[model samples]
Target: MAADEPTGTATLRDVARVAGVSPSTASRVLNGGGRAVSDDLSVRVLAVADALGYVSNQAARALRGQRSGVVLLGGDPRTASIAAMGAGMEEAGRERDVAVSITAVGPDAETHLAALRILRGLRPLALVVTSASFVGTDRELILAELEAAHREGANVVFIGEHDYDFPAVRFDDVEIGHLVARHMASLGRSRPAILTSAGHPAMEGRTQGFLEALAAAGYERDAIAVESVEISREGGRTATRRLLERAEKPDMLLAGNDVLAIGAIHEAHEAGLNVPRDIAVSGVDDIPIARDITPPLTTVSLPFMEAGRAALAMALDGDDQADIHLQSRLIIRDSTVPA
Candidate 1:
């Protein structure tokens, strides 16, 4: 064959011929069922397939009672946490020789329903959801679709809390709250204020745990103040300003996430209050930006990448009863050092 020949009409036979392998070997390697093949041979087969522009025939695979070897990951990719989860899923999918398809959608009932409808048409081997809030309000429709997927031998995995019956990779938000609060108390910061988002399960759980721990540490109800905000940088800044204007200012501010914590720090600086001096700040989900900010943030670290990998494993490996609980750890930074 000419080197410049068109590959638009390429087939598995063409790939096998180019790679010096049999058609069966090419099929096994390309279709992802040839785990016993030598690494060098597998690499050569994949490279040849790419050079020949060979694409798997999903229809033929389905006719042969085999799955399409695709996994669907549904969530908003704009969020930092969800984006990290997507990256993890993609890495795992590549290792398993499975294709990953992402469907970006908003966090609303109608949007989730629409995304689920689109997902059903794909008939993927599994569906992984990084956020439960997207499907929170339309549980009935989402659950029905999940049941149908289950009946069709497709798996469903959730990365966060959900009321549905699917397997989940959950973070210990309550425990993270307790850890952060206990750490703060250990630093002798008794008067603490919480800045959190309303109607968010993760945020609410963290707040509840923190308050409970503080109460147990001999802090009275009047000494602690909880404020609900938008769970954004601006929300943190605005809420912090309000807290600082009070007759009695809090000694520490606990934000729902790093973004809010950054905002709180900015506000404290504007007010000329030295961090860990006049006031201290802490947050959850030790995002990348947390460490880069001035006077690095004290926060709880959730295993975002591990959660994604676990969710994909549960779905692809058919571990329906798998309830993976990831532990969160407290990371003390310069922001929370005792004066």
Candidate 2:
């Protein structure tokens, strides 16, 4: 050890000072940059660095590159689709030697933006945002922040529909809706109803496609009832009860997701109405519980995990202009057909 070297763990600054050279010069020698420096000065810096045990900091290396090899995924981790997506991202990250960090963001835009801000401090190489639709000022604010991050060299990728000109991995929500409506029509269901929440752009797209396909099957938009409710099991139950009480009831109920479909089925059983016998029910998102219920639920299976893998691939491959479209398929079960 050098007589003047400090006893504790050494830093680059310490090594530079001991060697009587600028930090930049020491950094060039240590990193083996092509920039020319005196051979004698390089040797002195290397000796000082070795004596001080000054190791390179990964975080500092990232700063020099302007971003780290860490990918930040922002979404609601509790959701099944999000969980699957995280799994896919983690798998791909392991293969690529990149670190994937998942941050839970709230449904509201304010909370979502706050999480994004915190993750930005890490200067991740990519930011993969999987969130629901945002509107009004919230939408503008979110877009602005994302654009700013892009300008700052972070790859911004969205996992859902944003309708904006950005790299995205989107599910074929309209096709999912079309599939459900076509299946119901094949079952000879005439009267149809939509049960979903407002402000969900993807769900809205599904509803629109479902309505269009149903129209082709001889049911007009005015003939079908559409109801917007909170996205919860209780909300589905309450809405189903009200629909059942109407003078003219819908023969088919298409819910936004499986949880609501489960609720609808429960409410129908309480009313002594046999699912698919008196009224048929269906939903999107083929969650695990969808297949384990009394009568399995008929819903669409979205490729969330594939989407996650693709998102990471896009970031790593530097495909910032690519818009990848993933497909969804209908899972047939007894809920929409007679068992």
Which candidate number would show the highest TM-score if scored against the true structure? 1
Report lDDT (CA) for all predictions: 0.77, 0.77
Give the poorly placed runs of model 2, Cα more than 4 Å off.
1-66, 69-75, 133-137
Off by over 4 Å in 1: 1-43, 47-75, 135-141
Q: Give all TM-scores, in the order shown.
A: 0.80, 0.78
Give a tens-digit lDDT track for model 1, residues 184-240.
Answer: 877787578999887777888888888988888888967788888876799999999
CA shift of 294, model 1, Å: 1.1
Candidate 2 achieves a global lDDT of 0.77
